[model samples]
Target: MSTTKTYRIILSGGGTGGHIYPAIAIANELKQRFPDAKFLFVGAKDRMEMDKVPQAGYEIEGLWISGIQRELTLKNLSFPFKLISSLFNARKIINRFKPDVVIGTGGFASGPLLQVATSKGIPSLIQEQNSYPGITNKLLSKKANKICVAYDGLERFFPENKIIKTGNPVRQGLLDIDTKRTQAQTFFELDKDKKTLFVLGGSLGARRINELIEKELDFIIGHNMQIIWQCGKLYFDQYKIYNNTKHVQVHAFVNNMDYAYAASDIVISRAGASSVSELCIVGKPVIFIPSPNVAEDHQTKNAMAIVNEKAALLIHESDLEVDFENNFGQLMASAEKQNELSQNIKKLALVNATKQIADEVEKLLKK
Candidate 1:
């Protein structure tokens, strides 16, 4: 028998935790399976990944690139230059690392890294976390050795033959939240019996969703419902003192997300691809407030994919003012509706996506 070969893999993604965390989860699995494997990450320079990757105990290189500024600014003129620099840098990194395979999660840097990796005859894979594919993933797919997707109907974006609906790989830790529902109540000092609503605005938080909750905090309480609100870091300090009573609570971030998800009867969140993927597993009756700020309005497209299937409800940013509280009230009153959504969205859950992604990575190494 031949000896097993050690694999060196390069992982690329950044600009958001939605992309970074899944990359980490996939890397974590590879570490467990191939303890001898080497891994490197590439992310946009001066972005969150510079801090996050080191924190995750991985070595990452930075590309001097950014998204094209939607509003015309002097920085927008640097797009072509940045693209050229990133291409040169990606080639340098790939040649030095000599990885057997490359994996791209959605981010500003993934475009160049994966494109070069594919050109070099290395097997490249992309994990598209959204229901509607992002433009980077769409372009990368033409050369991707395999495309793993979370949502169906993605054939419109990638070659159908290369696509695998593996869902988003959620950290196993989140799924194993300490089964302490009452403990979560105590953790947040919440009323154990009152209906709990968890408001999430993606990994960072949604300003519009947070504003809506702030506007309707009293009405939410007056209706005899309790809340565990994650106001995101930006608005955290402004609202952290919102502990008017046991029925309402505010947090900058929920360290124990599994607890927050477990303690809640309802969730109000942005429709980020990862949020939608994890929510499908959490099985909460969710109100998706899709942000219009993202590229391609991907957040709304993600939410609509589920809403159109009747697996969830959508509240557009423009409609939040008029529809949020009223629709939320109706959802809270109807356990049947909540249960139906909960069951239906769970149907889309692929809990084994992490292992599956890793398995595919391992298979490529042998070939």
Candidate 2:
């Protein structure tokens, strides 16, 4: 009798769409390569992944996990307890699943799961989506078999030998959006005569971006510009009133992101890793406003990577109040500048990220 084992793989990452979507994208690529492979996902209990994973047609297990708050909060006190519980839980899942390979995209759940998988001598990899590695990825780097990174110079945070620059995995639909513009404008009900600006602040939303747009609504319209604003779930109630306004559509979430990217002439977004990658692929003239709330101020670093390449323009959140109008106006009036930014950012697009990362996983299985 011929015998070939069906490969089993474990993927853990969540807490935000930035982490969750990349994990899902990687899993999708892996499924395509190993048609009969058994895939399992581990995410923090109560996180969006618990709901998102099942929707993606993958079975998932949740760890009782969350991150330690930077401030002195009561949640920080329970962090140690949560860590211990998650490690134990991860071990149980590892033992039961006996995965041939384990992968962590980056989140609290990934921390315990990868740590346990590495300790058990299973092959494991981590996908770091930022220019600066997060605390979880940095700590887990010592034992990781491979570290797939989105940016260069992560050797400062991870082992030089394990690091591979695979870039960030973005939705494949964005790879060819030039043909979608007319269809996208029709989809969003946007006037083609007016310039369209896409405002994205991650899945949870950005308070400063929403506020700046709210204050500058008249300014935007006066310049013959329309906006498709993704206000995020948290701020939807506060900003949804603008949905009734002319030339403005405020959404809690943008489900049709491919269409949205196609419809945009300019993009004003937070510098989250996934957003940056998608924007690069969409090849739009972009203005980045990095969130100050992230650990190590990494969003700024992520934005700078592109900005330094002259691929995009950045406005620190603190500078928005003073520079929003002049900077936005100058970009709006200058077609030459817009084309330069679009072409430059497109040059940085890494369309094969998902495939490359999947290839890395396949290598581990062979080893």
Candidate 3:
């Protein structure tokens, strides 16, 4: 009788929840397929992933690594030292772990780890979750055996032969949100008769988005609309004062994300890759206020991808002060417009993204 072989895998990515969660989702799907696979995660030390990965039931190792801030600072001076240390640490991990496959989602830790893995001739894949690739992923693309992307035309950055347009992995549960609307309304104690607006700005929160909600609370309430506002963890207290009011509810984080999506007739969101993917699946009319602070201005690029398709509206952070009320009010007043955006965005949803990414890994494993 043949004994089953244990496949070893090395997955590296982190920093924000955007990178961490997709790496976790891909790992989860791979685990389902290779039940006996041994997995190890490499993330930047002190990053949220160190805690989040273990919470997701995986063992992880940390590299002494971080990104170089665009603006000059002391951290920029330390980047070379950090990169050297990370590369050395990465070599040690690869030699010790001896992974059959190395996978990188976009993050600072991924660069050194995947670079070291390729030097050793190990099979490697990268998952780029935006229309525009990040500096790390763009640099690593040359050696990657497969580049799984969430948008088309990234061949401008990656080798066309290596590109695979696999959409970002969103929470699988979000696919069934329509079935949860009634339960979500009940859970939030919202009136069944009022239209609900879901506002999301990602986990740490967005100052501009929080401020917009604060300024428009009365306007929304007066228009007979209810709100499920996820102001993010940072600004929760600052904005929590508006909660439980007649038509407003403020949350630091919405743990039951599917319910939040289900309860909404429309959404106001930041266009992070994971949020964009999930919002596509949620199929709600959305106004995307992309954060300007990200690398490569990728958030704006992400939102534009959808807007180009006429699937959603794009409001820059700079323009939100002038455009927020008018853009939102237009969507609110027109059911026909809302339906158009909803249907068009849903057409871009790749509900099987995790599985497709897993399939790419499976192919690499077979080689």
Candidate 4:
């Protein structure tokens, strides 16, 4: 908590926004608490974090590391070599940087970095964003001094004593969306009179979600609603044609997520941990389509946590065709349903997650 003590901290996480943004949020909070702190980020080479971390105004070092492929492939063959190389590089970085505390937010890069850090007897903490922990976080949990988690019941994957239910750190920008509603509508050039539907397919995009939206645009528009669709960069080229249509705007990536959340009435989103956290804070009626391609089918578990609370709806990719229209129609037809969901989900928001995680880090720094 002392602004004068210069604490060197290394935050590592990447490969997805779910991993990357939480690290950034934590770092941002810590920086505010310790204005003179020295910060460095470690992420996997060629991963999005290499660019994103620097963009968030921190220096980052990249390790020659990547996650192993689930299926047998040439990539899997090189896993051993990559792991060895990354471990060597992570050691060199740790020795040179001499961080007071290293933090991992769950990513392939965090595996090597945290492994080396813990072996050197340095204090380390990891943040697990999902209800179920990732392989990297699970492995790091053995040696990590603390495990900060967003969901309950994570003690099944982590040491019960080390686990803290601090919730996921959401971006500061998203915390005050209600104040930005009119400004967001103007920023997005949305008609104030029309209700908006926001579609998110995660950072890399979802093929099935895109297909469903493309196929059902008529049905959605027939309800007299406008749309702000983030189709992800991969699918933007294919879905950009919809931008020409009335009452619809398509984007590859939404830089202004606060505006995106504020300008929308209902949301259709993927069930990535970060997205779910943000959606909970945004407090919108949501329909979640969890990706089945993840390591442990964790996205479904994340969505089900909310759906079980009656805070949101879930439509698996397999059931989208049969259930999406009916579910969406009912939601759209009932304003009371929307308000109920919005109010219920809002109750679940852990708005102080970033500060609490920083408080934990401050504890580690003092030790």
Candidate 5:
């Protein structure tokens, strides 16, 4: 007689593409491996995941949750109510779903849901994409079955036995770049003759990155460089006017990032967990401009981890205005620099990370 096992998983994470994308990638891997698995996502009500998760072909439930305001504000008054409401809602979801496993990828919504799941004796796993774990992941570690980390030396935060160094999972398209360069150049309708530069500032875009790129558009082309700039959604309309007579392609988000990465000779972008992970897979020379506005200055730390290894370059937010164009042009002209960064970064690629994590999940499920 043939028998089948049904698995229920409660996946949680969001607040930004950095957290959302990695969670989705893991979910996709889990789905592929376990066709009988039932998956449910827990995200904050007003966040992007409510929309993005559904778009990724998954069902999601929202909690009336948000981060505690760092500064004294009226939202602080709502903090107690939000936490209570989220915990209450989380308990209801856990009771109803009866998830065999809960997975958190570091976001505000993950805090209560994973906590409640652990309290209920459900196996939980956390995929931490950064060098530093956040308060949510840190708090959840004590109860997590296995904590998969991308960056090393995370034992300071989580139990060593509970931790495994499975690197972050990146999007599938980004995993291979061989045939995509010509395809990407044609997709963006960019010229194959000129060296192309792509600028990405994460999903919402970086204000300082956008401002400097907009103001220095002329300087970019004057160096005889073609560009594909992801101006981000908020600045797309405002930056669209510059597309009139330049080799500049502007996008709010590049759906075909594989092609984009293949077509680009140099990248100007932000330093987020997923972005950094994908960049390592792309194995391209990057100039990272981390947003100073993030929590714990983790973006800078993420970028520096690579820069320290001679695998990528970093331009502080303050230094971009004075140094970006000159440095980018110099790097482009220096084939040696590009090769060094490319080869060194490729050494950091976790090509099988998604499947590795899925294997871990299966191991836990079997146990």
Candidate 6:
């Protein structure tokens, strides 16, 4: 309970922003509650977290680790060596830092670090953002003291006693998007009179989603809607030509997502864990185009949870061609449908997830 006790904490996660940002959000919440706490982030080397964690004003260390490929490729051949090296480095880091507790948000780097931390009898917790657990988190669950999760029915994978339905940690900026709607519209230079569609394809981008948006721009605009499309950095060159078109604005990446969400009437997004969590808070009518390329097809599973609740709609990649126009047209034609989706999705939002996860970590620190 003492703020001046100087607790040391280590957060490890990130092959993608889905894993990275949750760890950062938890760290930020913990920092405010314990101002003198020392924080260190552990992430995979050559990953985005190396750059991102530092930008968030924390020190970080990277391990020589990478996830095993699903196929029997050359990358899988290096798995053992990488694992051993990462284990050694993780032990060295834990020994030197002497953290009060360690937390993981599910990534390859977190595997070795949390393994080492638990072996040393350091109290530890892992946060699973998806409804289905990842392989790393599933393995770590045995030794992990607590498991923080976002969805229901995760007990099939994680130990029920260890599970806490803390929901996924969303960035604080997204919590109150309504207040920023007017300012966001001005920031994006969107016409207040036109209905807006916001397209998100994660940070790197989704090729299939980009193709759909490009192919359907004429159809969407015909429905009296404007577009704020985040085609992703990888596909920006291919889609930037649409930037000059009326009723459309394209960006490589959207840095101001709070503003982007605030200004939009409808959303078309890939169903990554963080994106789903943020959308639940933003509470817009969403048509999820979940990526098929992820491990275990988790994105589809993430979208289905909300779809079943009537909180959002789902259109798989293969169905987009045949189903996109009809589904979209129906939603656009009905204001009542949009309001229903918005209200249902908002009911699922856990605005205090960061604080709740941090509360679990604080309990570990106390013990």
lDDT, model 2, position 102: 99
- lDDT tens readout by residue for model 4, 104-144: 99788999999999999999999989887777778789999
Residues 1-367, model 3: lDDT tens digits: 8987799999998987888889999999999999999999999998888988998899999999988887889889888999999999999999999999999997889999999999899999999998777777888899999999888888899999998888998776787998998999899988999999888888667899888888889987777899998987779888888875778888887778888899999888999998899899999999999999977798998898899999999998889778878888888889899999999999999999999999999999998
Question: Candidate 6 residues 56-113, lDDT tens each?
Answer: 8999999999988887898899999999999999999999999999999988799999
TM-scores, in order shown? 0.91, 0.97, 0.95, 0.97, 0.96, 0.96
1-367, model 2: which lDDT tens digit per residue?
9977699999999988899889999999999988899999999998888988898899999999899888889988898999999999999999999999999998889999999999999999999999887777888999999999888888888889998899998876777789899999999998999999999999889999999999999998898999999998889999999989999999998878899999999999999999999899999999999999988898999999899999999999889889999999999889999999999999998899999999999999989
Q: Is candidate 3 or candidate 4 better by TM-score?
A: 4
TM-score of 4: 0.97
Model 2 lDDT, residue 193, Cα:
99
Candidate 6 yields a Cα-based lDDT of 0.92
Model 2 lDDT on a 0 to 1 scale? 0.92
- Residue 72's lDDT in candidate 5: 89
lDDT of each: 0.85, 0.92, 0.90, 0.92, 0.88, 0.92
* lDDT tens digits by residue: candidate 5, 1-367: 9988889998899988887888888889999888889999999998889999999999999999889877789988988899999999999999998999999987889999998999989998999988877787888898889999988899999999988888898887787687778778888888777888889999777888889888888888876779988888888898878788679878887777788899988888899988998999998899999988777898999999999999999999888767877787788679999999999998988889888888898998899
- What candidate 3 gets wrong by more than 4 Å, as runs, is none
Candidate 1 lDDT = 0.85
